[model samples]
Target: MSTSTSTAAADRTLVTALRERLQLDTGEAVSLVETHISWVLLTSRLAYKLKKPVYLGFVDFSTLAARKHFCEEEVRLNRRLAPSLYIGVVAVCGSAQAPHLGEGDPIEFAVCMRRFSEDALLQRLVPAGRLELDRLEQFAHRLASFHGRAQIAAPESEFATPDQVGRPVVDALARLRVDAGARPTRDLQTWIFEQRKALRTAWFARQRSGAVRECHGDLHLANVVLIDDQLTAFDCIEFDPALRWIDVMSDVAFLTMDLEAHGRRDLAFRFLDAYLQHSGDYAGMQVLRFYEVYRALVRALVGRFRVRAGAAQPGGPDYLACATRLARMPNSAPRLMLTHGLSGSGKSTMAAALLAVAGAIRIRSDVERKRLFGLEPHERSIDHPTNIYSREATERTFARLAECARTALQAGYPVIVDAAFLRRDERLLFRALAAQLHVPFSILRCRAGEADLRRRIVAREAQGRDPSEATLDVLERQLATQEPLDPGECAAVLDVATDAPVDVDALGARWLALSLPPITRRPAGWSAS
Candidate 1:
């Protein structure tokens, strides 16, 4: 018999035996969760994940040995993100007809994990109003740390190369056409194919630069949980390197895409802002929208599959709309917002707040400067303005910032240039770039009482957690050397005092009104796809 045919009978028998093997109390009941790929058995405090013995081209578990090996791999890979949950692998020691839980020659293997309240899952929390933007900010930081420590992809790995990255997108759209009618998404597919050149050139460089790593491939809200009052991720891709080894942004894109699919663009923007602030992956913007569009297609296709199998979910092909919308160049009022301030004046903070509101991609000098020389955002090897912050280095840093902004704005996003635009020339560079692109531009000039700036610098030094290694001396120099904003720049200036708490939304609303007019209706030749 074929693997599929035999597994059906085998799974039925295994389910019966596992129901008994768990040995629940007489009054309690056993619950089984089924999916296309695996079967999960919940037994009070533990969860047993049994891999279906079927071979999908991406993952094969057609034999006893294959199952055992992949079960072990799952525990190892998932533990990095869900450290306290994945217990280990357990063997179903006896025959399927009378499977023993843990004492005989092994017949099959199942991954054992600690079970938590289903309420903790993000999928549940999002609908119950328990998940909030502030909480997602914290979650973004935690996920960034996971990406920081994950194994870098092998030097020759093509998992993140454009061909591999684009393959799943092509496959998904094909499935969508066959299952949901081809007429709806013909334009979207055409757009993606036509833009492949630009997408591949920029994103492929990141892969070659070691940005690809073993990441939590399937990072949708459902695979995440708030265990022990801490947000955690689990059930990572283990059976296929092609799924797990990817650009770090691709991993983040899954969550952002999911949030957008659920009609939570503001929360999605918040998550992306916090994550990018922590990670400093500004240059990843070129790949972000590409992967987001692809991820949306994948989710859309999954929903369609479940429906065909009579698993009609509440949220239908909303992601199809999401994918199509993202694949096309959005009607964004692309604008440039540059930060002008002394060090420790809270430029990054203000920029972060603006990003959450505007959905703009931010590029920070402190972070990007360090990134240029092969450093993590928070890793420090030398003092500011001495080694990496030399005059020449600063020039390179600003140049990098300008290039990144140019690319992101061209790709249809508002851009936030986060730096001390302390010099008129520095501000002019961005101003001219905005003019060149014919986008609206603004300067967010941040200020604080000198004493407040001093106090912040001192406290920042005490903690030593910040990427900006600015000292009081550097701030003094900045104040002295800073060129005042020209009269011509006044029309676009937004002054912000950063020392006290203020409502960001109030300012954001004013800026939005000036720059982005609300869309009253769709333009000509508009189709939902």
Candidate 2:
């Protein structure tokens, strides 16, 4: 037999022996799972992942020392996010006929970890229709918090440089050509070059501003799981620092692209909007589309690999189509929408619904107001006390909202200012912004009765989870002084009744018709409503 075949045979024998002889915490039989690069031994309570003695261009585990180093690296890096899941590195010793998990002279290494239910994976949850928006929103907050504190790449590092950012995308395209036996379409090629050229400055700015970090390079839904009802991210790319050290937006794009691929665009936008709210990284949205296309192509290549292994049928072509669709940009320019309503009238809720179908980014006043004061979204204004809602503070908040709205609009994304636009000047500020940017603008006029508004305010206060600190007193004051849209402003208003159940799909459709310019063409499977 050839050397490769002989080595594979030996590796298989060793895996079988280890599975039979290891005395795991669970007394049940051990099951073995194989992948292109590794083998995992699953016991009831634990998992032992061993790298295959093989060399792929992107990774090398052919030598025992190399495997040992990567095993340790995996445990260390994955522990950054899923500390409880990774249990540290262990040795595989003894002869292949009598292998031991942690004994004798070490022949190999395995990263030991706590086993999680496969069903809890987001990959499974998406297809099963078990994924909920609330859980996804919570996960968004968790991921944003993690990203905020993740280690930033040094300026001297080779990561997130313009060259490095484009390398993987170029490589993914080359691999797709080879694997699919086809070149990318002319449109995709043109888009790739144009987007790369456009984002060069943004990439440099982001790198200087510490947007590049040691991130979870492989952040697809399959790598995320629900542990104890918490969305936990694990299995980060540890074999290659070049891949792991990337722009934070690239990391966000991976999960968002995967969510879109799973036909959950609404959830994708919800998660993204939530992350932006927490991280205040609206500036990163500029490069998001480029990274999204790259991520989709990477996934398409991965799908091809799985298909070659007879693991999936539609895996490759399906993702290829997704990449093509993602590459297709809207011919029309982006729009700006403002929410006009009192607190408890569901302005935020309507904004979220609009984003789901409109493909927009939402910038909320309450969130930005707290952020300006160095407070988290749900944090009380007790520290700022008297000045948290002062007229000056409100002015600052509106200015911040306009700033974020401009950023989003400039990034080629629709913008929704999800604030209680209770004043004419407040409304005019956004209108002027849209006019200055030369984008379409409209208002979602949210309405709720006084009784319903009072009840909602009380309930939201009791929950203590909303960013708004609006009390019944605040509502009463707003009711007394809030300005209604005049005749000219009424031309651009889309009325929404907040007291009754909202047909979100219908509202989204109406809002799009009233706000954005008509799309000349949509990608296959792309929907506006």
Candidate 3:
């Protein structure tokens, strides 16, 4: 018999015996799903994942010892996100001809996990219209928290720089062209290389500035599920450290690329906004599009691999189209909008809403102030006198905000300066900056009743880890000294009442539907209602 035939027969025998030997009370039989590198046996409420003896440039599992070690690693890493889902690993003993569970010497290793209904997967739910906005926001916050806690990749690590990080993308594109003869991937491939040329410098700077970290490497819809009413991510890359240790934006780009591939670009925007809010990592946007292109092409190449292996993957072409769309994305000219309000007047909330709908990058006082102090966004109350909101410190904070806004605006991205722009000079500084950049400018005056604002100040301070350090005294002082907009600013001002729900998407759609040139395309999920 041929070698391929012999291997297939051996695999079938091993799978059948595994189903019989593994203890499960599935009334009838267990179903097995085979992927390129692993076989997953599904029981009533359990899953057994056995790695194939596959060798690839990224990973090697050809040896029995290698499989065993990776099985243990999978359990250790995935438990961080899905502790309850990943149970433990087990040894398959006896023989491949008639294998018995844990009887003789170890032959194969399997990672056992608690399996739940597949319908709850975010991949499935998004297409079916069951994944709501609130749930997506929740998932974003959870992922942001995960990134915050993840260990930053050391500078000395081999995969700690952009050239090293993009090696896989380069390799994947080469494979796609070689396997998919005359597939017309040159245009898409050309655009990807162009973006590489544009973002190569920023990519390295981001890694040097600590944006690189150990992240959930394979964060796609299929690996994420809504378990027990919570969105849970599992099955991270375990065999390859190069894939797992990456710039955080590269990790976020994978899911967004997946969503766009499914014809759901609207959710992709929402997810990105939510994650940016929670993580306060706006600087990483420098390389976001670069990674998005890379990630989309990776999926496209994988689809081709499946097709060449005689597997049915009809969505492969759609993935390639997504890659081209991402690469050819038009650069929207920068625009500036500053928030006008006291500390607790809902400026941040309005800013977040505007960002979600308008596709604007936000620069916040609370975040940048801390950044000026070399502190994390949530780290507060250090260097009491110098960090205690002195006049000099406040000026320095706004200066840093302007610097950041300048960089983002010059890069052709719309910006939202999310600060308590109570001082006339501070507000005027950004307005002048917008004029200098020759972009449309607007001021969002976020107003709320004093009673509500005062209450909110107390509540916000009570919530520990809040970036804002505003107190009752601060609120009262702000109310006393707040300046009104000048008559010259009237034509470009927007008054926003923060007392109720504000669907900024719909509002933005209506406001920019005519007369105004939109900074970004309106979301398909929203209308001019």
401-424 in candidate 3: lDDT tens per residue? Answer: 887788777765678888888888
User: Against the true structure, whose TM-score is highest?
Assistant: 2
Candidate scoring better on lDDT of 2 and 3: 2
Which pairs, if any, clash in model 1?
A: none
RMSD of 1: 6.2
Q: Give the C-alpha miss distance for residue 31 in model 1, angstroms.
A: 1.6
Lowest lDDT 10-residue stretch of candidate 2? 520-529
* Each prediction's RMSD to truth: 6.2, 5.1, 6.1
Candidate 2 TM-score over all chains jointly:
0.94
| Candidate order by decreasing TM-score | 2, 1, 3
Better of 2 and 3 by TM-score: 2
By TM-score, the better pick of 1 and 2 is: 2
1-529 in candidate 2: lDDT tens per residue? 9999988899999998899886554567888888899999998888999999988888999899999999999998999889999999999999887788776899889999999889999999988899878889898998888889999999888898888888788888888898755467878878887888888899999999999999899999989999977888999998989899999999999999888888888788999999999999999988998888899988888777776788874532366666777788742357888999988999998898879887789999999999998999999997775687889999999989988888888988878999889898888877777766767788898999988899999999999999999999999899899998877568778889998888888877766665433532222333222
- Whole-model lDDT, model 3: 0.78
lDDT of all the models against the reference? Answer: 0.81, 0.86, 0.78
**Whole-model lDDT for model 1 versus the true structure?**
0.81
Per-residue CA lDDT of model 1 for 369-458, tens digit only, reads 897887777788575445887778888898888888988898788888999888876777777777667777888888899999999999
